[model samples]
Target: MLNKLTDAQVKSATAEGQKQRKIADGGGLTLVIRSGSKTWWYRYRFAGKQKTYSIGTYPEVSLKEARAQRDEARRLLSENKDPVMARRTKGIRQQHDAENTFKAVAEDWLQNQETELAAETIRITRRRLENWVYPKLGTLPLTEIDPPAVLKVLRRIEDQGKHETAHRIRQRISQVYRFAISEGRAQWDPAGNLSGVLKTTPTQNRAAIIKPDELAGLLRAIDGYAGQPATCAALQLSPLVFLRPGELRMATWEEIDLDNWMWVVPGRRMKGTKKAKRAGQVPDHKIPLPRQAIEILQPLKQLTGHRDLVFESIKPGRPISDNTINSALRTMGYDSSRMVSHGFRSTASTLLHEMGWQPEIIELQLAHKQRNDVAAVYNRSARIQERTKMMQQWADYLDSLKQGADVVAINRR
Candidate 1:
């Protein structure tokens, strides 16, 4: 077979009046002309069957390029492979690569996980991904991201002395890889084998002041905070209500009953598994508001009462950021090692348990997820009376503490 088509010949070729015309360039390559359009074709046989492979359009797929493509197809045939099937496989792989970028898979995971995960968990996960992972690995295809590439991103976070954050980002990356594998987007979790590769951050209990005198000092400091009044009120209310930072920050007026002295924290805001949240298996948490809580809210009501969120941020229509309370604490000379917003729960729980309150009552107030759903439902109303009493007394004890009363833990049980 000899080459029968030239670049000059191809430029002049046409099927102006005719519907279609074909010119063979030998050994399976052909030029098909349609009225004003031209295309390159490689007609070949594989496994005793004929197949026509479209190389590309005319000018784009020049004669020299078409010959190269035909030669490549011939080489595939010589290797006992079907060029058409081989080409289809390549195309499918390319499509998969395009659709399964690390960021694309992560976004899909987030959307798929929203129903299952608590709102706060979803928010934290998304924020972590957006800040740490996306900038480094987002555009890269999933399969192309090996352990080192993923580790490179984690390393940058670790280098900043954010070992815990680095670990968290690694966990997030691993989660996305797991999702990708489950969805047939990735072959293996590169992050899975790299567990020992990151610095191990020792888990420390949140910083809190359980001692009466120190806690009283913290209380007085909180009372004097001159930032936003809403924040000051939140600082005053956090320990009394026994809500997590997120639950406390996201409080809506609808959830509060000043008259009844209660705040109903919706299940979506409480911590739980994706399945529990998605199925609505996690029930709403009822908190008995102490008199002190009511006192703080009553006056603050005049300010933020018209808003949906009780602790509305300065920015309209949004709750305060998770860091707002912690930042305020920092502003007041308390660092992470000294105390945190979450430590308020720890502090109250410690002092309450030490003050002779039942562990069950404190756990219920803390909204710790119960292992047994049946027992959890049974205990929902188990100790409301005791909890209500404990709350009021807790507020009273704090009031006494703030007055510089060197008080011992009261045995109220």
Candidate 2:
């Protein structure tokens, strides 16, 4: 077939009156010219229907290159194949590979974990992933991720003094890789075998003022804490309730009954396997509030009466921040080494045990659920009246210390 256009004509091609014009080069090859740009197009019949394929743009794709591509398309047609569909299939395959990036793969892994992971666990994890992992390598192809790249991300967190969190993120990354490998998407775990590369977080007991006199001093400091009312209340309530910091901050008004002087934290909020929490397979943790607890909650209701959370943070619709109580402790001259928010649980458990409260009663009050469900249920129901009495007495003892009266519990009832 005789070609109607040459390399020179196509290179200098332009549209007339701002309208697009097409220059045919025979055998289904054509040059499409617009006012500002020229593009190469391959027009042919596929499945008895006319179709146009954009080869590329001018200057970028020379006439010689365009003709070669056009020839390939005709060859495909002669072989009884649709060039458009074939090219589209190739494009789609490329897109699929691109979509298997680190972020995408990690998300797929997280979805798979949802069946067994708690909702809160999943939320915090995804937040950590988005904050720590995604910005570094979220868009990279999963197969292209290397140990060096993974280590770099972990080291960034370690630099911020979050060695434990760095380790956690690394573990999550490794888990994602394992999931990928199981599905045959990845052949290697980039996050594996670098465990010793980072500093090992030390295992140690939490700092606590287990002595009554020292505990008195800390209680006085909390009383004088002139910060946000919500934060101040959290500080005061922490020692009284002795719940985990997360459990304490997330306390909802519905969970506590001032009239009955009791609080019942649901299994969903209690720490457990994701499946157990989502399925409500775990039992509730109940607390018998002292009269003092009621005094605090009564006035607190006036401040946050309309809100869902009793300890709602300054930011509306959210619970008090995870770090708020500890940050407030810092404000009152208590550092992490001196007194962390979680130390309240340690202090309460130790002193309660020392004061001659039954180990089972103390453990039950602490919501230390046994691994066996039957034992946990028995522990939950044990000593209900005595637990209520102990809470009232504990509150009274704390008041005496705060009043600057030296006192000690030497015997149990």
Report the backbone clash tally of model 1: 1
Query: Candidate 1 local accuracy as lDDT?
Result: 0.87
Please identify model 2 stretches exceeding 4 Å from their true place: 1-93, 110-124, 159-161, 181-184, 196-198, 204-207, 227-232, 301-309, 312-319, 405-408
Alpha carbon lDDT of each predicted model: 0.87, 0.86
Off by over 4 Å in 1: 1-71, 273-275, 278-280, 302-308, 313-318
- lDDT tens digits, residue span 221-255, model 1: 98999988878888888877768888899889999
Q: So what's the TM-score on candidate 1?
A: 0.79
Clashes of each: 1, 2
